[model samples]
Target chain A: MANFPENIVPSEMKNFRISIDDFIEAYNKGEAELVDIRVPMETKVWQVNFGLKIPANELPKRLDELPKDKLIAVACPHTDRSNMARVYLAEQGFNVKYLVGGLLGLMERLKGGMAKDINL
Target chain B: MKEISFDDYLKSFDYDERKAMKIKLNEMLKLYEEGKAEIIDIRFKDEYEAWHLGFGKNIPLNELPNRIDELDKNKTIVTVCPHYDRAEIARLFLKLKGFNARYLTDGLLGTVDYLRGDKARDYIAKIKGES
Candidate 1:
């Protein structure tokens, strides 16, 4: 039988969640990648100018497009779907984290005239 | 889990713009009040405690696999969160589990905005009448 990986440990789980501020910092430094996991309809309504747009359902097949070296931050409007995506990516041997509070929080942070603070 | 694929989800998006798989807030309220639909708030327990629509059962996304029996197959399950992202994910899962499910497109935040004044009263009155 083929050997499958075990579940992520409790201690390692803490590292799996990254705050938006931290994500922004890493993202600007080109050390992190954001994956918007929201569906096409939702993205059509509103979307960030940057970030790879792969819906959560499509992640399993579109894994090749993602970079293995950078820290991947999966985000939805909130953390739930991103967390699920993070787990899936982690299992597939990628360094990934669910964006804490997701893209909604990032939008709030980047709202108004402050949008230029984020380099990417 | 069932053998549903990403193509199935993509098909929903590609064909007819997903009008058949999504529910607006007004339609959800009407169907739920009439007992033809059930709302499933698929947020974390903390998020639900922070704010909720006061109807439907709270089933966190991760806990869904364990609590599949709680969902009624007879009624249309409308999965919801603040926005449609998590709700759509839950909807897809529920659909795969052999339940008639749809994502709340207008969203819980939109529903809250919509339920103020007379609209809220009438909806609550219907729920009270049923109970």
Candidate 2:
């Protein structure tokens, strides 16, 4: 995991944690946007609904294309790239939230027979 | 092979020492039931359809990059393959690419083994419904 400075932000911001249920709820309500940070090649085998592509390396230059006002949730095949992106955006003064556990986390949530109940 | 520096080698230590998730098959079954994790079948399309764990996503490692958009990034992902080599490689690749990924130690058959028992049937049933 990436290390964060002890006093990087106020307690509330520092302790912010997004759960799978929260993502599903937002997705179900169509209030959140899911952006996949994995490269195009990685997205071919399996993909989520309404998910967009913007590889992690290209995120910095493509910032303008993203909706700043909307609740943006970024993810990668794994959490490492997404975490890095989250930290980068947070540093740049953008209020973007990352999907915890990455794609795997979502799958886990779905496999336990909660697929239909997925908020989105 | 080209000569490598010690620092570079040290930095790559995690990649070299990578191992599968240490959880037991039964535990994985429980987690699956609780929607806490998902099984990912990393075999090729043909190999996967012939026989799979019954609950994991069939995402061929080579095809992962192109189809990555289909995955829900908020969940935990555990990749499974015949042995664990490809899954480990895929895990490292995803880590480098920024995903929270892990390789399943039990492989596809292990999941099947867990599913065969009465205790894991409900979990297996749940997985089947989702897939």
Candidate 3:
């Protein structure tokens, strides 16, 4: 079993999440790295076109693949799994935050002609 | 190998599918005590650490792929989460992968609410005493 994360306290949780808008802004500036944490079964149905594809369960062994300098923005279809990953990453000492609205909301934001905002 | 496709799973959806996809909390508890069910809490590890049902295995939804081997094929597999949403997701995935799986329709919190105080103690004592 994995050890419980060391970020349960309120003071540490204040910076646990980021809004979709802020994430988009950071994406444009290349100041953040988005990690899609969906499982293979779910990813087979719907998926994001860009971002690092790392399953949450495989993250412990894949830490070297992540960039330490950039702000790591972890996301799943919803906020649930991303929040879990954020706690784990924080304890491992990475600058991280979960996307508030999640990957589903992120995709929804980029729908229609608004995709150009991120140069997609 | 991928045993079943999403389209096939969706194509088979109907009233019978709905009935087959879920297991009530009481039935789940009974089957678990009878050694005929394996309850998997499919929430994340952090959520499991914060609080949990104190029984069943805590396998996060994302980890289900790697941990499939840990599950027993002979027993009924029941997936659970805070609400029924994630549980449903895990159930569908397990079913597609060929496990006789079901979601907790009343949910894990609902199960916890049902087994409070005297009910919880009696249930625990019975299981332990029987074993």
Candidate 4:
């Protein structure tokens, strides 16, 4: 994760914090753009089927790779780094959101099979 | 514990009856990834704790009656066990309870085999190719 400024609060960003259920729904509908902000090593074990992996430190240089029109959702192993990414992206003029519980929450949902209906 | 005869167990359900409750692994995986189905492991609690599918809840076959309330009726329920025996029974019971349900054709062992194979790698490569 990148070193975020100490004073940057989540409220400072326009990015929305989305729940795991909503994230899965957006992913299933092909309406969400995901950015895995974890390091490369984290992906070797597991990764979402959709998304580009641009680590938080590398994001500034890789901003050109992200789609401008899509609603971007940043994810990390936990929400802290994704929250940082969200703030950064929002400042860059992109429509962005941070996954509330990040990848761990997603893995839990997958394990429990308890996510709300994707269509609903 | 005395084991029941496999032959006698086979006679418990008719051919078409058994077939209707079974779901192919590929189909279950599809529903799982698409977020349309829930994987419910019907194995013993210890067996599930030892190892089980990465996604889904575990409500052992013996405990299903008491824990049935834990399941969501809105999503398709996919029951799994080491083999299909317990899973099939669980599937039928869930269906009777008015939840859409099916059992993994060969259960957890088959699902593990499938995951261990190249299918997961192929899926990752396919996703990379598209990106």
- The CAPRI classification for model 4 reads as incorrect
Please give the distance, in angstroms, between residue B99's alpha carbon in candidate 4 and its true position after superposition. 1.5
**Docking quality level of the chain pair in candidate 2:** incorrect
Off by over 4 Å in 3: A1-120
Q: For each candidate, what is the lDDT? A: 0.77, 0.61, 0.78, 0.68
TM-score, first chain, each model: 0.90, 0.76, 0.88, 0.76
In model 2, where do residues sit more than 4 Å from their true spots?
A1-6, A9-16, A111-113, A118-120, B1-131
- Best-to-worst order by lDDT is 3, 1, 4, 2
Task: Please give the distance, in angstroms, between residue B49's alpha carbon in candidate 3 and its true position after superposition.
Answer: 0.4
Report how far residue A113 has shifted in candidate 4, in Å: 52
**Better model by TM-score, 1 or 4?**
1
lDDT of 2 by residue, B1-131 (tens): 13333223224433223233234556666666677776677667778778766465887766777666666566556767775545654554454445556776666666665556774666656666743
Model 3, B27-58: lDDT tens per residue? Answer: 99999988899999987788899999768899
Which stretches of candidate 4 lie above 4 Å from their native place? A1-120, B1-18, B121-131
Report the number of clashing residue pairs per model: 0, 38, 0, 1
- State the displacement of the C-alpha of residue A53, model 2, in Å, after optimal TM-score superposition: 1.6
**Cα-lDDT of candidate 3:** 0.78
What's the TM-score of each model vs. the native?
0.62, 0.43, 0.52, 0.42
Best by TM-score: 1
